[model samples]
Target: YFQSHPAIQPATVVVEDRAHPSTSELSPTWNRTDEWYNYRSNPRERVHVLAALDESSYTGGTMNGDHPIAWCQDYQGGRAFYTGLGHTKESYADPAFRGHLLGGIRYATGHTQADCRPENGYRPLFDGTAESLADWKQAGPGSFTRSDDGTLTSSGGMGMLWYPGQDLGSYSLKLDWKMASASGDDNSGVFVGFPPSDDPWSAVDNGYEIQIDATDVPEKTTGSVYGFRSADLKKRDRALNPPGEWNTYEIR
Candidate 1:
């Protein structure tokens, strides 16, 4: 139930995000035999989808033609990856299948990097580079310092970095980030739906936030849509990389 977008039906998935390390080792349209489970929604444009079901290859598929079967995302300060494969016990014994699993683990653990940028008409909101932040406007007190490696580490007070170039309507925004704190107790979040304002409190009153403090309750912790909703803790835990590791988040 925690899976944001589950599988459509037990069938094979066609690799779409071919550049990702996990799917890069496989053929573009490899097929597998597994029990696919349907998800509540299609996570397309919301994640870097590695594989999708070739609807033509399956009969009961229902995500139009752009069905994602496996994907990776940056959750609140941690990596989040999901794949709807390996239902049957025999899947574990298959060498090709095992390799796929290993590649995913490598990408998730930050042992390797992948081009997880979300496509589907989404543009960079914050790409961890100074050029990307040319129009970024900070509000509140503390600050995030940009490093030579294109990472923004928190250094100052409590504030927010927002895009000031244009007004965002309905679009998927993706970013890669990492919390340097070892205990994962950092205070960070992504706010949406609020207009540009000098006072950060305006955001607090008008916008919704996806919090990054990983040590709180399900409703108030990392991956939570603030106090209104809680991420599925079990699924979140499985997908999260620890502090000091890079993670990605795609907010739609």
Candidate 2:
């Protein structure tokens, strides 16, 4: 079910699933050259699309306006990943492209974890704006500082920042994070399924924390359902980027 433009051309690659390891390190929009491919039927109904070609940036596109170039899915008992990238010899030598290929390989080989469920219509809880923090309340000592780049950095934190909006039931939360410390010795977490409370400990007692301390024990380290079950360490390690590099989390 493959169709393509006759000649290799430059196209803008738009990242759709930044939470996927294969696309986590990519910018929202990037330019690359490839023999753009189209399918007889859009696979968005089946696989989770990681990236797509921006048809407006190029001349020939057979799939109308939507053309997915990279995707992943769960197979019989394993996994499958596909990408229209790496069509040129230079693609293999590009660090970013190599990392993308490695991530896909890791996912397909069961060395990393990714939520390959088809995603659609996600509303933003925090859209990285100073105005978005209006409904959020800080509990305890430390607070987060909003930067000019639309990022919130934690400082002097023995506390927690939470949203006290409508209760979320059956939801998916996605966020990008990076440790400021070169040593990767930062401690933090995203608490979920908690009730409204002024005390940060309320979350610890009533809900779960997706822990984010890489130096801690398995049960308390990154990807762990804090103090309850440990994540697959091998998979987590493979999925985790080093400190100072961004990582995306998809918590459902």
Candidate 3:
């Protein structure tokens, strides 16, 4: 389903799946030289694209307008991952490239957990823009402060910042977050499938919470469906980055 171009080319690889372990630590736009491959058909419809070539950055690309360089999927009940990187000897020597390859192997080997199903129709709920922030309202004691960079940080909270927009159903929610404290003890959570109520406890009592504290017990720790179920700790730990680094959460 693919053929390589004749010459080595330099291009920027735009990361499409920040939540995937393979591309989590990578730059949003990674510049490198490699033998770009042209697939007969776009694999995005069949796989979860991890990263792709910025065709505009290089000449002689053959994928027309879209070029996927890395992707992963479940093929006949087995995990399959592919990347068009590492085309040169120097690529293996590169630390970032090595980590990328290792992470892919880990996922394929079932050492880590990632949602590799084909993702589609996801729209931003909070895209680090003030205009986008208009859809949310803060309730309770502490309020969230929006920084110039479009990140909202909770200053104090016995309360929650919630979406006051239309009720959602059968949806997926994704967001990027990081701990501000160096201690790695700070805790927060995203409550889902909750009913509309001014009291923050309404969410706690009515919906499921995807916990965000790394140091808590399994049932209340990171990746846990708080008070309901604990994530597979081994996979959770393997997939999670250390505190202070940005982490993406995809809750469906």
lDDT value for candidate 1? 0.72
Tens-digit lDDT track for model 3 on 84-189? 8898998998999998998899789987667788877876777656888888887778988887655678977688989978888887787777776776677899
Off by over 4 Å in 2: 62-64, 89-93, 120-155, 159-161, 174-185, 195-207, 214-252
Q: lDDT at 12 for candidate 1?
A: 56
Clashes of 1: 7
Relative to the true structure, candidate 1 reaches a TM of: 0.56
Q: Where does candidate 2 have its weakest 10-residue lDDT segment?
A: 1-10
lDDT of 1 by residue, 1-252 (tens): 233333434455676544455765465467777766556677876787878877677576566677777898877777777887887888899887887788788888877666665677655555445777776888988776876544566667667777778887887776555566899997778899997897788888999998888998889888899989999898777656677655556688
Native-referenced Cα lDDT, model 3: 0.83
Q: Per-residue lDDT for 79-106 in model 2, tens only?
A: 9999988888878888889989998998
Model 2 shows how many backbone clashes? 0
Candidate 3: list runs displaced more than 4 Å: 4-6, 126-167, 175-186, 193-208, 214-250
Better of 1 and 3 by lDDT: 3
lDDT of 2: 0.83
